[model samples]
Target: MFIRIDGKQVEVKKWDTVLSAARRAGIQIPSLCYHPALETAGACRVCIVEVFEKGWSERKQVTACEYKVQPDLEVYTRSESVLKTRRTTIDLLMARAPQNAALQALSKNVEYPQTIYPPVADAGDCVLCLLCTRACEQMGCNAISVSGRGDTRKIEPPYGANPDACIGCGACARICPTGCIALTETPATITIWGKVFERLHCVTCGAPMMSIAYRDYAVANRELPEDYYTQCQECKRKEVTARFAGLSMKVHHG
Candidate 1:
């Protein structure tokens, strides 16, 4: 089938969407939610284009990603109608994700003139791009998915608890564009009275030790054998005391 995009003729397969045809013909269309490997949801509506039929019908806006090309169809990707719809769509997206760097950059290029929208509420660094959900499902983790519907929907781990399948690999945190995911690790420190206290794990016992206590008791300090660092807290204490007492007696006798 043949379609005309911006007055240029392009060939397309029977079921090819306008987006795929334009892309194959080297035309650029800005889109965020249309991943080639996934089903097109048309949720973002950023790829809308104007379709013109030869008769008295007015040009209509349709999402290029989901609009299948018909034989002899004429499409104007850069028409005033298409540009207006795209700019408005971008403005709405920016209103929802003002802090999103990608969205901000896109908005600048698209010339979304009006800025009267209210500030996004507690955005949580999520632009709702759906990348996390795609990763979870496609990567076999299924560790995360979008919960709720519409504006209330949010990405959540399984059952809202840390997924039992989570390997702590931090893939979700890394893929997140908004920095919303909070990955937990061992507690590291506490601040009190404007002073920061460091937490120390005993090399031998794997138990939490007070950094101040370890530093103050010199007699309790002794270097363990390289392999002894894995021993428990009680074992480390006994080893240190035994070695220190022996050394004290030898020095006194000498």
Candidate 2:
């Protein structure tokens, strides 16, 4: 497909979003809550762009992550209206998460000035992008979710108590842009939200693999083989190698 971005013509493939096209054209657009591995959420309005059709004189502002590129479309990644909207959005995000390093980096990218709005009181560092929850769901854990609405919103386990499904995989924490989720790992345990999960060790080599909860969770989801959890990676490799060696010997003798 062919499109015009900042008055420059660019070529892209089908199903490519404006963000992907901008990336291909070497244009930098700040975005959060958008991961290549996960779905396009458009939770953060930081990637707003102005778009005009080939025959249309009016341009409309839209989220770049969710807007697909079309032939003869004109896209402006840094239009004045887009910058003003981004500044407002960034300022609000900064007010909501003053200590968030990701927000700080975004502020620099958009040239956001010092926030005029007062910081929210008692607001945790979570930007509420739902990236963490989406990531957990994609990993087949579905252990965490957003609770409440508006000002009282928070990321927590369902039922507002200890999570019954958390496997301590730390995928949520790793995908979190604000780093609100805390995951502490030791040789024997992995802890999150005051829940301790015992890390399972290999039966053959006694090497640590992952938390028992994760193994159980995977087993419940049928993501692992019946005997897959019995050994660590190294031991599994050795067992496969030994079996192949024995098979080769039997074939030679026969």
Candidate 3:
């Protein structure tokens, strides 16, 4: 099917959203909570766009990341209404996360109305996009989740529960857009989520790689062997290439 975005018709495939279609057509849409590697969490609402349906005379404001494209659907990515809504959203996000680098970069080109609402108390680094929690879940470790309600909500392990599910893979920290989740690494350990795990040093080069807990998880569940995981990635590649070259030599001689 095809949809018109910003007065240009773009072809869309099955289950394609406005955000994806626009990206394919070289249209840039700002989003915070959407990651292709993870499920769509339209919590940010930063990618809102005005939509016109077949019979609807009025444009409906919707999140471009979650709004599936339909035939003859008209989308205005930068219409006056969209710009007003998005600019206000950017300002509100800036208020909530005043130190967020991404929002700072966005503000360089986008005008802000500077809504006078006070910054959320104890807001910290999290914008509550839930990407960290979602990534942890997708990584098969539900070590953390959203807690509390409304203004008190934050991401952490469940109350009274330890972070036993965490493998120290740092997936949450890696996927978080706001740098809310962080992992500290040392020569012999990696610390995160209130836990410090032993490092898995590569047997070949003695280089610290993933945590021992991460190695255990990958070996047991990701169908990798312990011996292979013990080697550094570059060393492993070199070993494999050498073996392949030896086999080729044997074949050539035979």
Candidate 4:
């Protein structure tokens, strides 16, 4: 299918969103909550684009990540209105997470106005982007979530207590954009979200890897041998190497 973007024709495939079509045509639209691995949230309004229809000469604004491309559709990536909306969105996000270097860089790139509001207090520089929460859910933990509404909203376990279901896998910390989730790892333990977890070490290299809770979770969810205990990743790799070496020796003898 073909769509007109910024007065230029762009080719799009089936099920392509406006952002994807624009990206295929070398357009860059800033977006925060539109990860390819997660479902489209459309929470961040920074990717708003203008669309024009045949019958309606007037253009309307819509988010590129959630809006699908249509045949003969007219899209504007950087219209004056779009830039204004993006600037306002950046400024608002900056107020929520002034310490976020990524948001600061984006604000500079977009030339956002000085934030009228102060940075949110007691948030640990979190912007409430939901990236960490969504990542945890994707990993099948669903350990963390957003609590409260509006200004009081923050990421936490249920009822502001330690989660029994959390495996200390660090997926939430890894996906967090603002680096809000703090994770500490040691050979014997891992600490995250105000809780500690026991870690499993490799048999051969003695390097700490997955947590015991995570190993148990994997065993319950995935198919594995009954006798399999929590072996660290390094030991598993060494076992594979030893088996390969034995096979090579047998072949040479034969």
Candidate 5:
């Protein structure tokens, strides 16, 4: 289907989000909590856009990331109303994490002097986007989640304790938009959620790979080859490329 964004008609496929289509068409719609690898989340309203559907006299505001493309969908990425709403939303986000580096970087978008709302205590860069929690579940760890509600809301492993199910995969920390979750890794150890796990290494190159817990979980679940983690991915890719090149030369000579 074709959706009109900023007066430009862009062809979009099924399951395409308005944000993805706008991005594909070179239209800029800023978003914070949206990741292609993770599920669609409209938690951060930074990508709000004004939509003028057929026969609608006034524009309606919606998040571009979660908004599905529809027939005759007219989207205005920089409309005045949209900007006004975004300005307010950004102000609120800034207040949520007053010293957050990500929100500070986002301040360049609009001319909002400062937030009028009171700042929360000990509120770090965590906008509470829930990407980390969602990612944890996606990794099959399900180790962490948001606890409490309202101003007392916080993300933590059960009872704010170290999680036993976490494999120290660092998926949650890697996907975190605002550096909310902390992950520390060394050559032989990985630490997160107040737990420490031994790092796995490639037997061939002695290169550090993933945590031992992650490898064990994956191997147990998928029944991967015993030597699957013996070599690092780089070494395996090199070996495959060498074999392919040798085969190609053999074919050419034959």
Candidate 6:
């Protein structure tokens, strides 16, 4: 198939998407949701391209990442229609993540002139870019997914807590363009290979215990592991003994 991108003619395969074809011709198309390893979700709508057929009367704005190339397809990556659509998409995304450095840089790259949009609510900094969702489903992690719908959508772990199957690989956090997923080493209570265990003071005995003890407590309490439970040395000692002895003896006798 013959494709014309940015007024340059190039040969393209039938199954090649417009983005890929543009890449072959050394034309740059700015995209956030398009990843080489993931399926095209067409969520961001940022990589819009104008497509025209030899016999068609009107050109169409299509997502370059999702639109397949056809014979005699004329693709314009920077046509007025494409630019206008992309600019609008960028503006919406910027409004969603105004503090995001990557989004700010993307706005500058597209030369999107900002206009007044509605004030963003106190929402978490997720652009719904689908990187986390794609990674979780496609990469065998299945750790996060979009919960809620529309403006309330958020990338949440299973049951709004860290998934039991999560290997803590940080793939979702790495691929996220907006800083929505916050992954940090904050004395996790789980134990696995390559994990360094720290000593959390036992509440009763003033003895050092596994940091994972907090996780054990959460599991026993049927609570999410993300919640913090801490007991200093003396308090942990009393609580542990109270379980075996009477509470009065453990408290008054101690």
> Model 4 scores what on Cα lDDT?
0.81
Q: Backbone collision count in every prediction?
A: 4, 0, 0, 0, 0, 11
lDDT of 6 by residue, 5-72 (tens): 88899889888999998898888998888888888899998888888987899988888999988887
The TM-score of predicted model 4 comes to 0.84
Candidate 5: C-alpha lDDT: 0.84
Q: Residue 75 of candidate 5: its Cα lDDT?
A: 93
Candidate 3 residue lDDT tens string, 1-254: 88999999899997999999999999988898899998898898889999999988799999999999989999998888888888888777777777788777665535663535577788887888899989899888899999988777889997936688988989899888888787999989999988999998766667789998888887898888667576678767776897888732111110
RMSD of each: 15.1, 4.9, 4.6, 4.5, 4.9, 13.8
In model 5, the Cα lDDT at residue 57 comes to 90
Better structure of 1 and 3 per TM-score: 3
| lDDT tens digits by residue: candidate 4, 1-254 | 89999999999997999998988889888887778888787877878889987798699999999998888999998899988888888888888877788787778767764676787776567777788888888879999998998778888999889887799999888777767789999878999988899987655456678788887887788876643754555566666788888732111110
Best by TM-score: 5
Q: What is the TM-score ranking, best to worst?
A: 5, 3, 2, 4, 6, 1
| Worst 10 contiguous positions by lDDT, candidate 2 | 245-254
Model 3 CA lDDT for position 196: 94
Q: Write the per-residue lDDT of candidate 2 for residues 1-254, one digit (tens) a residue.
A: 79998999999888899999989789888888888899988888889999998677699999999999888889998888988999899989888888788998888877875677888888889888889989888987788888887767888999877787787888898888888888888889999966998998887767777888888877878767866687778777787798888742111110
**Per-residue lDDT for 32-141 in model 5, tens only?**
88889889879888999988888889878999999988888999998888888888888888887977777777766766757778987777778888889889888888
| TM-score (all chains, Cα) for each model | 0.62, 0.85, 0.89, 0.84, 0.92, 0.70
RMSD of 6: 13.8
Q: Give the CA lDDT, 0 to 100, for residue 151 in model 1.
A: 62
RMSD of 3: 4.6
Better of 4 and 5 by lDDT: 5
Q: What is the lDDT, from 0 to 100, of the residue 113 in candidate 4?
A: 45
**TM-score result, candidate 6:** 0.70
Q: Cα RMSD (Å) between model 2 and the true structure?
A: 4.9
Residue range with the least summed lDDT across 10 consecutive positions in model 5: 245-254
lDDT assessment of candidate 6: 0.71
